[model samples]
Target: MKSDSTVLPDVFRICFEHYNTAKNLPTGKIKNPNEILREFDFEIKKNPADAAELFKDMQLYLKLTPNTLTPNFQNQLFSGLNQYALAGDWLTSVTNTTMATFEVSPMGTLVEKKLIEHMNRLVGWENGDGTMATGGSNANMISLLVARNKMFPEIKKEGQLNKRLIIFVSEDAHYSFEKAANILGIGLDQVKKIKTNPNGEMEPSHLEEMARVSLSEGEYPFFVAATAGTTVLGSFDPIDRIHEISKKFNLWLHVDGAWGGSVLLSSRHRHHLKGIENVDSMTWDTHKMIGTGLMSSFFLTKHNGILRSSHNHGGEDYIFHESEIAEWDSGPSSLQCGRRSDALKVWLTWRSLGDLGIEIQIDNLFTMAIKAKEMILEYKELELMYEPSSLNICFRYRSVSDVNTLNKKIRHRLLEEGNFFINIATRKKETFFRLIIVHPDLNETHLYKLFSDIIRLGNKIKEETEFCMVKT
Candidate 1:
């Protein structure tokens, strides 16, 4: 709490200590959450007086560190944490600055504005506008807010009537879009789900027919959210065809590329987002694909200064002080106040990697997916749900006659046994393992063993399903 420079060493020491502990800890038997939290709180409360008690030789705490940095850690979209991203985050916290106003945070505001413009250029919009959001979901919500404002300009000043102003999305789209509709005071029922193809891509014709049916039923169709990369399935709805439908009906186009947007950097995969430049707005999360630590989400638009029009709250008498060097603050144009300098992390990442590094990372992830598919096909016991569109692979083991129960038993056992951790998802009432291939270090050998372990566990647990179900 004294000189900032003097305190920095302790911060670095403590951070690295925790990092090493997490990296070295045992993978089995996740420590009890409640006990760990109680101990952690006790440590926090004794902070200045007893920092040593909280950590002794780096063996403390009750939470699983989730070794996402390790190649075996494939449960999440973001795997390895970039050193530049962490450096930016630590500096931002030490400065303890808020990004509300240019005057209060001149450098931060400028950095964010410039970053927005830089991102806009890639989307082929020279004059597009945007705001860095808290997370991908919040960014998706902002997209809905902007679209609603554009379609019903009055809603900005005069709230939404229960006119059933509907929005359309594919069945495979991220669930955050629904949360956005609910937050905007649009009932959850107002979100219409269009059917998708076997590959999980949204059917454009189905969307068109659904729009016609909505119109026939006298419901207002105002927005359509297309997914560039779905969370579980890793599917992309055709942007070009979806744009055609949006134009035919004058609907606002919002692309949720939270998980897949970073592919924009890849010259080869860029064609997958062909008509992305035509969309009204987009939600992109650098944290997911760029490995920029956590929460690097941006809500971007083609229309200049449209974000300010949609979200700028009224009467800034205190923060937006006028002066000879007056500048507009980011707060007035966002739903957040006291925003962390999230821009710093993204800026550091962009500055360090530039566009090419990001492209290589993306291309490598897709290439890894290709190798993963080959490995899955080679194993006679496993079945792939669909071809991976990005980095997630949905597949299950195909054992003898009664295999589903065996596969489910193996997955539950893997989590309990805890040599490695993976996720499972249910689609059309069928449950299957969902392997994420985001980390660059995860090669074919790791995946091969992971699949092998599942089958071994499946055979091991087939006899004790009834006993283990009620064991824990």
Candidate 2:
């Protein structure tokens, strides 16, 4: 690795410009790809391509990047970046080592193990094991894979064996659960969806009913993926009740806490995930809740060393060399041969904040959600969709007619206006907005502006549509 001056400087300036332009979102000008990139492919063909010229081209790319940092950038679950985590990311890139090998990513592997140990303790697991994954979905998938393997080890070698193996998840569970089921060769149909209540929490009775049906229908119901925090509604399925059913049915209980798992740090609110300690496995995404850099997700299991039994693959020689007490290489426990040092970012973020810092942050976010709910309820024009179980407040503005269509148009107008961005969701065949309070910078003013802007837009849209309807 020759210290390439041009490439290094180019990448740095590019990143700087990216951080700058990400917030300057376009109001109406969005050129099509045909006119924007203009070419099908691009590469670093030559050396010293003039820093000034390179910087200009990079700025254009930066302008297109999503401004995940802004208070108005509420398009997804994770809305901001942690400064500490971002610094760790820079160090990670500088080290540039694959996480699979101990000799290369020794520190990275140890950091992840430490993080897992800390997280397991947070979950109240006395003896547990875990591994960092590419994303929450991948982590969730691995959870299913490991649970399946642990429940039916013979299937690993014998392969499904036409037993019609099935897994269960709430209808409100993330789509990743189904995707994981598909990848494990269980087929999409084998992923049964349990019904949920109006608030979006999975009904425990529904889970038991589904399990009975599956068993009677001659299908093996071996797993139940519960959601600690569903993406759209932020609902928590009754984990304690679900755990009881799982224990009674001999099911491998896995909780998808990628979105809401951070509550483990909030001692005041950790009870929201009651009995999570009893679950067989769980997926937690620090990146989503803690604002760690991307891909900081972990799949943890209470069964000691089950990941090795589940995901251990590839070479039986050379790499898995002899060591006194096991070398602790991450490759054997992962789905990928070469994982990144994603753990360091998460580790640094957690270490910097400590459990107390995280608790405060989590508490703050929850308070913000409560504030948002109160503000929404105060507005006669605003309708509280479902009582927020966690940090996501699902609601939309109330209007005279075409409530769903009006809400959708107001959302579209709000996005096009570019002052703010709140995501719209459809639940039970009704349209509404889901305001996420995950970003640390969001405060009362932010919530007030969001509600005020929404009402303003709703009124404008209602007037326009009503006049149009009258004319028609």
Candidate 3:
């Protein structure tokens, strides 16, 4: 726990400098293993290295890593860390505490509870229960666990019964639902994929029919997951229509809003999740939309006390003391015993922005998404794969032949050039770049630059191919 006084200051100086200059740096440069080895001395030695030498290594590592802070970096669901969120993260690290008990994490526990309460109310739950999860995937699993335990309470002690338990989700929903099924011992076969419309929203009629078939086959249909924002197409399922069917079948309704849940803050875009409050549970990640840093995910439930009852193990007598505040412990509700204080960054971001500031941030991103679409339509070379429902805008460069191949090549070349970092996804056998406009500073200029880069690289590839064919 001891170090040279100058070492700490030197490390902070490098980090602060990088944060200040990241926007000006390259988004990322894809490097092969040999090239990376040449660039960085990544070997571990038995002896401690000089502090100055280690600091230099840190700088090189940061330089080589993708600069996600830049507006051009849109490869993933999240971008741009809020300054206050970073400050809160530093504070949490310095404190070095677990969130298992209120006695150990008094402020941490209160912050998590306050955030959960605020988010629950927004989801239309007046008196609901919730907990911070490790990530969106973990939150989705928690929802499934609670739903299963609630329907078959005896399974807690007796284990799963002979009856096959079934869960339903849209064909385009996040893959975490299926993963959760496997983890919960609900066989992959029991995770039914409901049909989605061309826009990627779940078809309520198809879900109802599938539920009926499950019942006819004597299967236990207990859960239905609707997506607020699917990964590839950024589409929102019709929650109100889906709710009607869930009620008819007596299924536990869960909304997976990990990507687009922040739209709840937007007065204009909240309608996409109009009936979210009616759902039994929800998964929302503030980090994805609000720049609250990583792992700011919450699993909220309208059913109070369900999570604690479903997960409580009645741990050792030493840990679970019979104190008045023992009920405030979060360990029972969470999947992990020693959970990190994930809520501090979220609270700091929320407090800095307030509700209205978050609304403006989301509203602006939606506006930019529409603008990106408009620009794509103006050019014949660029094809808009699907109308944007959120910030994800999928499109590809047009080629008379090998359109998919051409788009893939363009993406690869873009990464190699290290000018921008975006991602591509395939839907219905077509591949296109899934441009994310989540970064707050992202604007029309960055979008144009992206399109220009793709077109430029795509045309170059086509010319080279034509020349090869002519020579042959």
Candidate 4:
């Protein structure tokens, strides 16, 4: 709060305090929009406020926000942040450097390059190219852009040709593929959603049939996105079989491994992504499975210079100078001009926990998922929506009437209670809870408690609903 060299240290103290508090907090206290507006002063003023006032505001903000760092939190793809990752992120912020060029970010550049090299080798690529993206969605978009430009180079400048370029993705694939298509001028209609099996894995035969039909209809099939971990079901499409289909059609194979790519480190679970070496490009987010901080996403490609060729454009005459080190600059190969050093946190985290450490973390999550499934099966009131494939275990408390509505209400009540925070998703018109075994500290006790809460709350909601109906 005071002006001087000590201000930063004071802020760090507050941060550490908040971090300690967050780790121990039971699920976050959920605040509605109206309550948040009344509870905090969010308006920005033209005049500079006292440092003490601003510090108080910062504390209040942290207090009101959801505690995603806590072990009880399992609402999203990512969970607790790694300590080394936090340290690196703080260092990166204090340094305040951009990652466009090596000259500006010498250590950052080398760190990113080395991290990419290490990750590429893990994915079975000997000399692949990669770049750190803003998020997993951006990584997927970059993959799509690179694939498109490689397949149709002229489209980069000359725009769309006579043919309607088509892309294929499993029905379970992330929606980012469709968003990428729209951004690239490839119509959303051209993005065909190939049907998946009952287990949510994409069917290669269906993809082949669809590609054949598209070709017969005079459409160009250029790309196929195979998901390594689907959003709702955590299903990994059979990469070996899908690779065969991609080869037959001459389509660029992009594996969207944003959620499950960390499995590559696990010898036991790595079989989920078999034939990953054959993929033209991939998206992997260490923040999700590896517990690096938020938004540590990478877009990797087997093609050497395709990314630079696809995204590069001549600009910034003042900034672009002929120099020996210019070639090492990562600016030309990315979608953003002024990129933050997202690689530093991941690099630090990876260094803190070597490849084996990463493997153990991922392997533990997979084992926890299996344990969760077994616990669900043991409960008669709970229904396992789908077979366990990865860390994502979908299930719900069963009710005789209006099960979908009941599950939705149960989730709402769960959040309102603020003892546990989880997520729910619907498939085939059936709503169910998507319990992710993502947190490093989540265990059988937490799973047992979650199931108990769901059943207890579900019965209460059903009884209230029936009582109201009878009164009406």
Q: Pick by lDDT: which candidate is best?
A: 3
Q: What are the C-alpha RMSDs, in order, of all predicted structures?
A: 3.3, 2.7, 1.2, 1.4
Instruction: Give the per-residue Cα lDDT of candidate 3 at 48.
Output: 85
Candidate 3: tens digits of C-alpha lDDT, residues 1-472: 3477898788888888888888666698888889988989888889888877887888888878889988988999998889889889988998989998888999999999999999998988889999988889999999999999999999989999797999999999999988999988998999999999999999999999999999999999999999999999899999999999999999999999999899999989999998998899999999989999997999999999899999999775767677889889988887888988989999999999999999999999999999999999998889998988888899889888988898888889999999999999999999999999899988888888889998899989999999999999
Q: What lDDT score goes with residue 369 in model 4? A: 91
- TM-scores, one per candidate: 0.91, 0.93, 0.98, 0.98
After aligning candidate 3 to the native by TM-score, how far in Å is the CA of 115 from where it should be?
1.0
Per-residue CA lDDT of candidate 2, range 144-211, in tens?
A: 88888888899988898878988889898999988887778989998888999988999999899989
Q: Identify the superior model by lDDT, candidate 1 or candidate 4.
A: 4
State the lDDT of candidate 4 residue by residue for 286-393, as single tens digits: 999998988799999988888889998975596656799988888988888788888899999999999999889888888899999999999999999999789899
Off by over 4 Å in 2: 1-50
Q: Report model 3's TM-score to 2 decimal places.
A: 0.98
Off by over 4 Å in 4: 1-6
* Candidate 1: Cα lDDT at 359: 90
Clashing pairs in 1: none
lDDT of each: 0.82, 0.83, 0.91, 0.90
lDDT of candidate 1 over 1-472, digit per residue (tens) = 2344544476577677655554433344434579567655443443364345434423343344545655666677777677788888888888888888776777888888999999999998999999989898999899899888878899888888657798999998889888988888997999999999988999999999999999999999999999998888888899999999999999999999888888898999998888999999999988887888888899999998888888877545776666664446788678887898888988998899889988998898899898988888988778998788878898998765566566677777786776667878888877788888887556777788788888787756654755787796
Backbone clashes under 3 angstroms, per model: 0, 0, 0, 0
Q: Give the TM-score of candidate 4.
A: 0.98
